[model samples]
Target: MYTISTKLKVILVLVGALCFSVTVALAQGPGFDEDVEDVPVPFDGGVTFITALAAGYGIKKIREHKEKTK
Candidate 1:
């Protein structure tokens, strides 16, 4: 189990809330046309690799933080 300090938890919650709100806004008020064509190909190998790297880094950071608290 991980124990997060009150301040750290509050900060994390605020940041997550901000991110969630921003994502919701972007999704709701889309500037891009849904019927638009000629869009670039979706998610080549490089994009997949980058996404995997980001997820791995986030998991590693969380694990390290938990270890430190222990």
Candidate 2:
């Protein structure tokens, strides 16, 4: 039983490590041969609004829970 649990733990650790692996590539800018204008990413406003709404909802829920407890 102990060996099985230890093997399960080791498998879980390996799986977790594999799941969270990240690959990133960084470059200074457009190459000297290429000319480009940097354009801002789209839909950021919607994302920001969604994030704020979620945060407000969380805060409201916390406040209600606190009031109920008191």
Give Cα-based local distance difference scores for all models: 0.88, 0.83
Q: Per-residue CA lDDT of candidate 1, range 1-70, in tens?
A: 2456877898999999999999888887546777778768776799889999999999999999999999
In candidate 2, which residue ranges exceed 4 Å CA deviation? 1-37
Candidate 2 lDDT over residue span 1-70, tens digit each: 9999999999999987766663222324545654667778798688999999999999999999999999
Candidate 1, RMSD to the unseen true structure: 8.5
Angstrom error of the Cα, residue 10, model 2: value is: 8.3
Question: How much does candidate 1 score in TM-score?
Answer: 0.43
Please give the lDDT score for candidate 2: 0.83
Clashing pairs in 2: none
Worst 10 residues of 2 by lDDT: 22-31
